[model samples]
Target: MRRSGPAVEQLIGALIPRPLPRPIPTPAPLPNLPPPRAPTGPNRIELDVARLVRAGRCSARTLLHQLDWRPEHRLVVDVADGTILIQRHPGGRVLTDPRGALTLPAAPRQLCGICGGDRIVLAADLTRDRMTVYPMTVVVRLLAEHHARLADGRRGR
Candidate 1:
Protein backbone atom coordinates (compact mmCIF):
# COMPACT_ATOMS: atom_id res chain seq x y z
CA MET A 1 0.00 0.00 0.00
CA ARG A 2 2.82 2.43 0.97
CA ARG A 3 5.61 3.64 -1.36
CA SER A 4 7.97 0.82 -2.59
CA GLY A 5 11.13 2.91 -1.88
CA PRO A 6 10.31 3.09 1.85
CA ALA A 7 9.69 -0.68 2.08
CA VAL A 8 12.91 -1.47 0.12
CA GLU A 9 14.98 0.89 2.31
CA GLN A 10 13.50 -0.69 5.46
CA LEU A 11 14.34 -4.15 4.19
CA ILE A 12 17.90 -3.17 3.35
CA GLY A 13 18.33 -1.43 6.70
CA ALA A 14 17.12 -4.53 8.57
CA LEU A 15 19.58 -6.71 6.64
CA ILE A 16 22.65 -4.57 7.38
CA PRO A 17 22.68 -2.56 10.59
CA ARG A 18 25.82 -0.45 10.55
CA PRO A 19 27.52 0.45 13.80
CA LEU A 20 30.30 2.89 14.74
CA PRO A 21 33.37 0.79 14.05
CA ARG A 22 35.93 0.58 16.85
CA PRO A 23 39.62 -0.10 16.48
CA ILE A 24 40.47 -3.82 16.33
CA PRO A 25 41.96 -4.98 19.60
CA THR A 26 45.53 -5.88 18.92
CA PRO A 27 46.72 -9.26 20.21
CA ALA A 28 48.73 -8.97 23.41
CA PRO A 29 52.25 -10.20 22.92
CA LEU A 30 52.52 -13.75 24.20
CA PRO A 31 54.99 -14.46 26.98
CA ASN A 32 58.32 -16.00 26.16
CA LEU A 33 58.43 -19.80 26.34
CA PRO A 34 61.19 -22.08 27.54
CA PRO A 35 63.57 -23.73 25.16
CA PRO A 36 63.08 -27.30 24.04
CA ARG A 37 63.46 -29.55 27.01
CA ALA A 38 65.36 -32.73 26.78
CA PRO A 39 62.95 -35.61 26.51
CA THR A 40 62.31 -37.60 29.62
CA GLY A 41 64.95 -40.21 30.31
CA PRO A 42 68.38 -40.11 28.76
CA ASN A 43 68.97 -39.67 25.06
CA ARG A 44 72.37 -40.10 23.51
CA ILE A 45 71.81 -37.09 21.29
CA GLU A 46 70.78 -34.85 24.15
CA LEU A 47 73.86 -35.87 26.07
CA ASP A 48 75.91 -35.10 23.04
CA VAL A 49 74.32 -31.68 22.75
CA ALA A 50 75.07 -30.89 26.38
CA ARG A 51 78.62 -31.99 25.91
CA LEU A 52 79.06 -29.85 22.83
CA VAL A 53 77.49 -26.84 24.49
CA ARG A 54 79.80 -27.22 27.46
CA ALA A 55 82.77 -27.63 25.16
CA GLY A 56 81.78 -24.41 23.38
CA ARG A 57 81.18 -26.16 20.10
CA CYS A 58 78.06 -24.02 20.07
CA SER A 59 77.38 -20.82 21.94
CA ALA A 60 73.95 -21.64 23.32
CA ARG A 61 74.04 -18.97 26.00
CA THR A 62 75.27 -16.31 23.62
CA LEU A 63 72.55 -17.06 21.11
CA LEU A 64 69.84 -16.84 23.78
CA HIS A 65 71.18 -13.50 24.84
CA GLN A 66 70.99 -12.28 21.26
CA LEU A 67 67.43 -13.52 20.63
CA ASP A 68 66.07 -12.36 23.99
CA TRP A 69 64.55 -15.78 24.44
CA ARG A 70 61.51 -16.54 26.54
CA PRO A 71 59.55 -19.52 27.80
CA GLU A 72 57.07 -19.41 24.90
CA HIS A 73 59.46 -20.68 22.29
CA ARG A 74 59.48 -24.45 22.09
CA LEU A 75 62.04 -26.85 20.74
CA VAL A 76 60.52 -30.15 19.77
CA VAL A 77 62.08 -33.33 18.54
CA ASP A 78 59.73 -34.83 15.99
CA VAL A 79 61.12 -38.29 15.42
CA ALA A 80 58.34 -39.13 12.99
CA ASP A 81 59.32 -36.26 10.71
CA GLY A 82 62.95 -36.66 11.69
CA THR A 83 63.10 -32.95 12.33
CA ILE A 84 63.52 -30.45 15.13
CA LEU A 85 61.42 -27.41 14.50
CA ILE A 86 62.11 -24.37 16.66
CA GLN A 87 58.82 -22.54 17.19
CA ARG A 88 59.79 -18.99 18.00
CA HIS A 89 57.59 -16.01 18.76
CA PRO A 90 56.20 -14.47 15.58
CA GLY A 91 57.76 -11.04 16.01
CA GLY A 92 60.96 -12.30 17.53
CA ARG A 93 64.01 -12.17 15.26
CA VAL A 94 67.37 -13.91 15.37
CA LEU A 95 70.60 -11.85 15.14
CA THR A 96 73.74 -13.72 14.31
CA ASP A 97 76.54 -14.38 11.90
CA PRO A 98 74.78 -17.01 9.75
CA ARG A 99 78.01 -17.62 7.87
CA GLY A 100 79.97 -18.50 11.00
CA ALA A 101 77.21 -20.83 12.05
CA LEU A 102 77.32 -24.11 10.11
CA THR A 103 73.59 -24.65 10.51
CA LEU A 104 72.31 -28.04 9.46
CA PRO A 105 69.60 -26.14 7.63
CA ALA A 106 71.67 -26.61 4.49
CA ALA A 107 72.15 -29.36 1.92
CA PRO A 108 72.65 -33.07 2.77
CA ARG A 109 69.53 -32.55 4.88
CA GLN A 110 70.22 -35.15 7.56
CA LEU A 111 73.61 -33.77 8.48
CA CYS A 112 75.34 -33.96 11.83
CA GLY A 113 72.94 -32.20 14.20
CA ILE A 114 75.81 -29.80 13.71
CA CYS A 115 75.05 -29.80 10.00
CA GLY A 116 71.94 -31.72 8.97
CA GLY A 117 68.59 -33.26 9.93
CA ASP A 118 65.65 -31.45 11.49
CA ARG A 119 67.31 -30.99 14.84
CA ILE A 120 69.14 -27.73 14.29
CA VAL A 121 72.40 -28.33 16.09
CA LEU A 122 73.17 -24.64 15.84
CA ALA A 123 72.96 -22.33 18.83
CA ALA A 124 69.50 -20.70 18.91
CA ASP A 125 69.55 -17.39 20.73
CA LEU A 126 65.97 -16.83 21.68
CA THR A 127 64.52 -13.76 23.29
CA ARG A 128 63.46 -16.16 26.04
CA ASP A 129 65.68 -19.23 26.15
CA ARG A 130 68.39 -21.07 24.32
CA MET A 131 68.81 -24.61 22.97
CA THR A 132 71.21 -26.67 20.94
CA VAL A 133 71.13 -29.68 18.67
CA TYR A 134 74.10 -31.73 17.48
CA PRO A 135 74.09 -32.81 13.87
CA MET A 136 72.07 -36.04 13.67
CA THR A 137 74.34 -37.22 10.87
CA VAL A 138 77.35 -36.60 13.00
CA VAL A 139 75.76 -38.59 15.76
CA VAL A 140 74.88 -41.36 13.33
CA ARG A 141 78.37 -41.41 11.93
CA LEU A 142 79.90 -41.46 15.38
CA LEU A 143 77.56 -44.26 16.38
CA ALA A 144 78.40 -46.23 13.26
CA GLU A 145 82.11 -45.79 13.79
CA HIS A 146 81.79 -46.96 17.38
CA HIS A 147 79.78 -49.94 16.23
CA ALA A 148 82.44 -50.73 13.68
CA ARG A 149 85.17 -50.43 16.28
CA LEU A 150 83.27 -53.02 18.30
CA ALA A 151 82.67 -55.14 15.22
CA ASP A 152 84.80 -57.94 16.65
CA GLY A 153 82.86 -57.76 19.92
CA ARG A 154 85.21 -56.46 22.65
CA ARG A 155 88.10 -56.63 20.28
CA GLY A 156 89.61 -53.51 21.97
CA ARG A 157 88.76 -52.04 25.37
Candidate 2:
Protein backbone atom coordinates (compact mmCIF):
# COMPACT_ATOMS: atom_id res chain seq x y z
CA MET A 1 0.00 0.00 0.00
CA ARG A 2 1.34 3.44 -0.88
CA ARG A 3 1.45 6.13 1.86
CA SER A 4 -1.82 8.02 1.98
CA GLY A 5 -2.15 11.46 3.68
CA PRO A 6 -5.44 13.13 4.82
CA ALA A 7 -5.83 14.51 1.28
CA VAL A 8 -5.41 10.96 -0.20
CA GLU A 9 -7.93 9.61 2.36
CA GLN A 10 -10.36 12.33 1.37
CA LEU A 11 -9.87 11.36 -2.27
CA ILE A 12 -10.58 7.67 -1.47
CA GLY A 13 -13.63 8.69 0.58
CA ALA A 14 -14.93 10.66 -2.44
CA LEU A 15 -14.22 7.60 -4.73
CA ILE A 16 -16.13 5.21 -2.45
CA PRO A 17 -19.73 4.67 -3.53
CA ARG A 18 -22.57 5.65 -1.20
CA PRO A 19 -25.28 3.14 -0.28
CA LEU A 20 -28.48 3.33 -2.42
CA PRO A 21 -31.49 5.34 -1.06
CA ARG A 22 -34.39 3.55 0.67
CA PRO A 23 -37.09 2.30 -1.70
CA ILE A 24 -40.32 4.33 -1.73
CA PRO A 25 -43.37 2.46 -0.37
CA THR A 26 -46.21 1.90 -2.83
CA PRO A 27 -49.91 1.31 -1.95
CA ALA A 28 -51.48 -2.05 -2.77
CA PRO A 29 -53.22 -2.30 -6.14
CA LEU A 30 -57.03 -2.08 -5.99
CA PRO A 31 -59.22 -4.97 -7.23
CA ASN A 32 -61.17 -4.66 -10.47
CA LEU A 33 -64.55 -2.92 -10.06
CA PRO A 34 -67.82 -4.65 -10.92
CA PRO A 35 -69.95 -3.52 -13.88
CA PRO A 36 -72.84 -1.20 -13.17
CA ARG A 37 -76.30 -2.82 -12.97
CA ALA A 38 -78.86 -2.04 -15.68
CA PRO A 39 -82.40 -1.11 -14.75
CA THR A 40 -84.97 -3.65 -16.06
CA GLY A 41 -88.09 -1.95 -14.68
CA PRO A 42 -89.47 1.48 -13.93
CA ASN A 43 -87.70 3.03 -10.95
CA ARG A 44 -88.89 6.29 -9.44
CA ILE A 45 -87.90 7.99 -6.19
CA GLU A 46 -89.31 11.48 -5.85
CA LEU A 47 -88.80 13.22 -2.53
CA ASP A 48 -90.32 16.69 -2.44
CA VAL A 49 -88.85 17.95 0.83
CA ALA A 50 -89.76 21.52 -0.03
CA ARG A 51 -93.36 20.50 -0.67
CA LEU A 52 -93.48 18.57 2.59
CA VAL A 53 -91.99 21.52 4.49
CA ARG A 54 -94.42 23.91 2.79
CA ALA A 55 -97.33 21.62 3.62
CA GLY A 56 -96.31 21.49 7.26
CA ARG A 57 -95.86 25.28 7.44
CA CYS A 58 -99.19 25.89 5.71
CA SER A 59 -100.99 23.42 7.91
CA ALA A 60 -99.57 24.99 11.06
CA ARG A 61 -100.38 28.49 9.84
CA THR A 62 -103.93 27.53 8.85
CA LEU A 63 -104.52 25.77 12.15
CA LEU A 64 -103.25 28.74 14.11
CA HIS A 65 -105.37 31.07 11.99
CA GLN A 66 -108.47 28.91 12.41
CA LEU A 67 -107.89 28.73 16.15
CA ASP A 68 -107.52 32.53 16.09
CA TRP A 69 -104.04 32.50 17.57
CA ARG A 70 -102.33 35.88 17.57
CA PRO A 71 -99.28 36.51 15.48
CA GLU A 72 -97.32 37.60 18.55
CA HIS A 73 -97.86 34.31 20.30
CA ARG A 74 -94.82 32.07 20.69
CA LEU A 75 -94.73 29.26 18.11
CA VAL A 76 -91.48 27.40 18.44
CA VAL A 77 -90.43 25.37 15.40
CA ASP A 78 -87.68 22.81 15.89
CA VAL A 79 -86.85 21.41 12.45
CA ALA A 80 -84.09 19.15 13.72
CA ASP A 81 -86.46 17.53 16.18
CA GLY A 82 -89.36 17.96 13.73
CA THR A 83 -91.60 19.40 16.39
CA ILE A 84 -93.70 22.51 16.90
CA LEU A 85 -94.52 23.74 20.39
CA ILE A 86 -96.77 26.63 21.25
CA GLN A 87 -96.09 28.05 24.70
CA ARG A 88 -98.49 30.95 24.74
CA HIS A 89 -102.28 31.10 24.66
CA PRO A 90 -104.34 32.50 21.79
CA GLY A 91 -106.84 35.21 22.48
CA GLY A 92 -109.36 33.85 19.96
CA ARG A 93 -111.96 31.19 20.69
CA VAL A 94 -110.68 27.66 20.07
CA LEU A 95 -112.91 25.01 18.46
CA THR A 96 -111.43 22.25 20.61
CA ASP A 97 -110.57 24.30 23.65
CA PRO A 98 -110.11 21.62 26.31
CA ARG A 99 -109.06 24.11 28.99
CA GLY A 100 -109.50 27.28 26.96
CA ALA A 101 -106.81 28.97 24.81
CA LEU A 102 -104.93 30.17 27.88
CA THR A 103 -102.46 27.77 29.49
CA LEU A 104 -101.38 28.43 33.06
CA PRO A 105 -97.92 27.52 34.26
CA ALA A 106 -99.40 25.20 36.90
CA ALA A 107 -102.18 23.82 34.72
CA PRO A 108 -102.29 20.21 33.60
CA ARG A 109 -100.91 19.24 30.20
CA GLN A 110 -103.38 20.05 27.42
CA LEU A 111 -103.96 17.36 24.79
CA CYS A 112 -106.13 19.28 22.31
CA GLY A 113 -104.45 20.03 18.98
CA ILE A 114 -106.05 23.46 18.87
CA CYS A 115 -104.56 24.40 22.25
CA GLY A 116 -100.96 24.11 20.94
CA GLY A 117 -99.76 22.94 24.35
CA ASP A 118 -98.45 19.64 23.02
CA ARG A 119 -95.74 19.04 20.46
CA ILE A 120 -96.72 18.41 16.83
CA VAL A 121 -94.21 15.84 15.68
CA LEU A 122 -93.47 15.36 11.98
CA ALA A 123 -91.78 12.35 10.45
CA ALA A 124 -90.68 11.45 6.93
CA ASP A 125 -88.96 8.17 6.28
CA LEU A 126 -87.84 6.49 3.06
CA THR A 127 -91.22 4.80 2.54
CA ARG A 128 -93.61 6.64 4.86
CA ASP A 129 -94.47 10.05 6.28
CA ARG A 130 -96.49 10.75 9.40
CA MET A 131 -97.48 13.56 11.73
CA THR A 132 -98.87 13.66 15.23
CA VAL A 133 -102.34 15.03 15.95
CA TYR A 134 -104.66 15.05 18.93
CA PRO A 135 -108.43 15.31 18.89
CA MET A 136 -110.50 16.62 21.75
CA THR A 137 -110.98 14.11 24.57
CA VAL A 138 -114.45 15.60 25.14
CA VAL A 139 -115.61 14.21 21.79
CA VAL A 140 -114.78 10.63 22.85
CA ARG A 141 -116.38 11.20 26.22
CA LEU A 142 -119.54 12.52 24.57
CA LEU A 143 -119.68 9.54 22.23
CA ALA A 144 -119.33 7.18 25.15
CA GLU A 145 -122.15 8.98 26.93
CA HIS A 146 -124.35 8.72 23.85
CA HIS A 147 -123.60 4.98 23.54
CA ALA A 148 -124.43 4.45 27.21
CA ARG A 149 -127.69 6.31 26.78
CA LEU A 150 -128.64 4.15 23.77
CA ALA A 151 -127.72 0.97 25.65
CA ASP A 152 -129.84 2.04 28.66
CA GLY A 153 -132.78 2.83 26.39
CA ARG A 154 -132.50 -0.54 24.68
CA ARG A 155 -132.31 -2.38 28.05
CA GLY A 156 -135.47 -0.56 29.27
CA ARG A 157 -137.27 -1.58 26.06
Candidate 3:
Protein backbone atom coordinates (compact mmCIF):
# COMPACT_ATOMS: atom_id res chain seq x y z
CA MET A 1 0.00 0.00 0.00
CA ARG A 2 1.23 3.57 -0.84
CA ARG A 3 0.66 6.72 1.23
CA SER A 4 0.40 10.32 -0.07
CA GLY A 5 -0.05 12.82 2.76
CA PRO A 6 1.72 15.43 4.99
CA ALA A 7 3.10 12.54 7.08
CA VAL A 8 4.85 11.00 4.02
CA GLU A 9 6.22 14.42 3.04
CA GLN A 10 7.61 14.93 6.57
CA LEU A 11 9.23 11.43 6.48
CA ILE A 12 10.89 12.12 3.09
CA GLY A 13 12.04 15.58 4.20
CA ALA A 14 13.63 14.12 7.28
CA LEU A 15 15.50 11.46 5.22
CA ILE A 16 16.88 13.90 2.60
CA PRO A 17 19.60 16.42 3.41
CA ARG A 18 18.51 20.04 3.26
CA PRO A 19 20.50 22.83 1.71
CA LEU A 20 21.99 25.47 4.02
CA PRO A 21 20.24 28.82 4.05
CA ARG A 22 21.83 31.51 1.96
CA PRO A 23 23.63 34.30 3.85
CA ILE A 24 22.30 37.80 3.61
CA PRO A 25 24.37 39.88 1.18
CA THR A 26 26.04 42.99 2.56
CA PRO A 27 26.71 46.07 0.41
CA ALA A 28 30.34 46.69 -0.52
CA PRO A 29 32.11 49.75 0.88
CA LEU A 30 32.31 52.75 -1.41
CA PRO A 31 35.72 53.96 -2.58
CA ASN A 32 37.05 57.33 -1.52
CA LEU A 33 36.58 59.69 -4.44
CA PRO A 34 38.83 62.58 -5.30
CA PRO A 35 37.53 66.01 -6.20
CA PRO A 36 37.31 66.72 -9.90
CA ARG A 37 39.62 69.32 -11.41
CA ALA A 38 39.74 71.38 -14.60
CA PRO A 39 41.66 70.23 -17.67
CA THR A 40 45.22 71.55 -18.01
CA GLY A 41 47.00 70.29 -21.13
CA PRO A 42 46.41 68.06 -24.14
CA ASN A 43 44.74 64.97 -22.74
CA ARG A 44 44.34 63.12 -26.03
CA ILE A 45 46.78 61.02 -28.06
CA GLU A 46 47.51 61.58 -31.77
CA LEU A 47 47.80 58.75 -34.30
CA ASP A 48 48.89 58.60 -37.95
CA VAL A 49 50.26 56.21 -40.56
CA ALA A 50 53.35 56.79 -42.67
CA ARG A 51 55.50 54.74 -45.01
CA LEU A 52 58.98 53.62 -44.03
CA VAL A 53 61.54 54.56 -46.61
CA ARG A 54 64.54 52.53 -47.68
CA ALA A 55 66.87 54.88 -45.80
CA GLY A 56 65.11 54.03 -42.56
CA ARG A 57 63.29 57.34 -42.45
CA CYS A 58 59.62 58.17 -41.86
CA SER A 59 57.72 61.44 -41.85
CA ALA A 60 55.42 62.14 -38.97
CA ARG A 61 55.55 65.92 -39.12
CA THR A 62 52.01 66.48 -37.98
CA LEU A 63 52.43 64.31 -34.93
CA LEU A 64 55.79 65.85 -34.14
CA HIS A 65 54.39 69.32 -34.40
CA GLN A 66 51.59 68.43 -32.03
CA LEU A 67 54.10 67.37 -29.44
CA ASP A 68 56.33 70.42 -30.00
CA TRP A 69 59.13 68.23 -31.37
CA ARG A 70 61.07 70.39 -33.79
CA PRO A 71 63.84 69.94 -36.22
CA GLU A 72 67.24 69.11 -34.64
CA HIS A 73 65.62 67.60 -31.60
CA ARG A 74 67.38 64.42 -30.45
CA LEU A 75 65.45 61.22 -29.96
CA VAL A 76 66.17 57.87 -28.34
CA VAL A 77 65.03 54.85 -30.32
CA ASP A 78 64.15 51.50 -28.84
CA VAL A 79 62.43 48.28 -29.82
CA ALA A 80 60.03 46.40 -27.55
CA ASP A 81 57.60 43.62 -28.40
CA GLY A 82 58.22 44.02 -32.14
CA THR A 83 57.40 47.71 -32.01
CA ILE A 84 59.66 50.72 -32.20
CA LEU A 85 59.58 53.51 -29.65
CA ILE A 86 61.01 57.02 -29.93
CA GLN A 87 61.33 59.53 -27.12
CA ARG A 88 63.02 62.82 -26.61
CA HIS A 89 66.20 62.39 -24.62
CA PRO A 90 69.47 64.20 -24.10
CA GLY A 91 72.44 63.04 -26.19
CA GLY A 92 70.31 60.69 -28.32
CA ARG A 93 71.89 59.44 -31.53
CA VAL A 94 68.79 59.99 -33.67
CA LEU A 95 67.67 63.47 -34.57
CA THR A 96 64.81 65.20 -36.33
CA ASP A 97 65.98 66.64 -39.62
CA PRO A 98 65.41 70.23 -40.72
CA ARG A 99 62.60 69.05 -42.97
CA GLY A 100 60.85 67.34 -40.05
CA ALA A 101 61.93 63.82 -41.03
CA LEU A 102 62.63 61.22 -38.38
CA THR A 103 65.42 58.83 -39.21
CA LEU A 104 65.18 55.47 -37.49
CA PRO A 105 68.33 53.47 -36.87
CA ALA A 106 69.01 50.26 -38.76
CA ALA A 107 69.35 48.14 -35.63
CA PRO A 108 65.88 49.03 -34.28
CA ARG A 109 64.28 48.59 -37.67
CA GLN A 110 65.82 45.17 -38.15
CA LEU A 111 64.96 44.11 -34.62
CA CYS A 112 61.33 45.07 -35.15
CA GLY A 113 61.22 43.10 -38.43
CA ILE A 114 60.15 46.07 -40.53
CA CYS A 115 61.57 47.03 -43.89
CA GLY A 116 61.23 49.73 -46.47
CA GLY A 117 57.86 50.52 -48.09
CA ASP A 118 55.98 49.14 -45.09
CA ARG A 119 53.13 51.23 -43.70
CA ILE A 120 53.67 51.91 -40.00
CA VAL A 121 51.36 53.18 -37.30
CA LEU A 122 52.64 56.28 -35.51
CA ALA A 123 51.14 57.03 -32.14
CA ALA A 124 52.13 60.28 -30.47
CA ASP A 125 51.38 60.76 -26.83
CA LEU A 126 51.55 64.47 -26.19
CA THR A 127 51.55 64.35 -22.42
CA ARG A 128 54.11 61.59 -22.21
CA ASP A 129 56.30 63.01 -24.98
CA ARG A 130 56.65 59.62 -26.62
CA MET A 131 56.01 58.11 -30.04
CA THR A 132 55.33 54.44 -30.78
CA VAL A 133 55.75 52.83 -34.19
CA TYR A 134 53.89 49.67 -35.06
CA PRO A 135 54.94 47.94 -38.25
CA MET A 136 52.37 46.41 -40.57
CA THR A 137 53.57 42.91 -39.71
CA VAL A 138 52.88 43.50 -36.03
CA VAL A 139 49.52 45.01 -36.83
CA VAL A 140 48.51 42.03 -38.90
CA ARG A 141 49.62 39.63 -36.19
CA LEU A 142 47.60 41.49 -33.57
CA LEU A 143 44.52 41.44 -35.78
CA ALA A 144 44.89 37.75 -36.37
CA GLU A 145 45.12 37.05 -32.64
CA HIS A 146 42.03 39.12 -31.94
CA HIS A 147 40.06 37.33 -34.65
CA ALA A 148 41.14 33.94 -33.35
CA ARG A 149 39.95 34.85 -29.86
CA LEU A 150 36.60 35.97 -31.26
CA ALA A 151 36.17 32.73 -33.16
CA ASP A 152 36.97 30.72 -30.03
CA GLY A 153 34.41 32.66 -28.00
CA ARG A 154 31.75 32.05 -30.63
CA ARG A 155 32.47 28.32 -30.66
CA GLY A 156 32.15 28.19 -26.87
CA ARG A 157 28.72 29.76 -27.07
Per-prediction TM-score to the true structure, in the order listed: 0.24, 0.23, 0.68
RMSD per candidate (Å) reads: 19.6, 21.0, 12.5
Q: Please report, as a residue range, the 10-residue window in candidate 2 with the lowest summed lDDT.
A: 47-56
Q: Once superposed on the true structure, which residue ranges of model 1 sit more than 4 Å away at CA? A: 1-130
Ranking by TM-score: 3, 1, 2
| Model 1 whole-model lDDT (C-alpha atoms) | 0.42
Candidate 1 local lDDT, 1-157, one digit each (tens): 5665644433577778889899999999999999997544433222223233322233344454455443344333222233333334455333333333322233223332333123334434333243444356656776899999788678655
C-alpha lDDT (0 to 100) for residue 7 of candidate 2: 50
How well is each residue in 71-140 modelled by candidate 3, as lDDT tens digits?
8899999999999999999889898887877788999999988898888999888889999999988889
Clashes of 3: 0
Give the Cα lDDT of each candidate.
0.42, 0.35, 0.88
Report the number of the highest-lDDT candidate: 3
lDDT of 2 by residue, 4-118 (tens): 6665424576778888898988989999999996533343222121112211221343333334444545432221122222333344221222222222111122223233332
TM-score computed on alpha carbons, candidate 3: 0.68
lDDT of 2 at 87: 30
* Residue 155 C-alpha lDDT in model 1: 66
State how far residue 119 of model 1 sits from its true place (Å). 5.3
RMSD of 1: 19.6
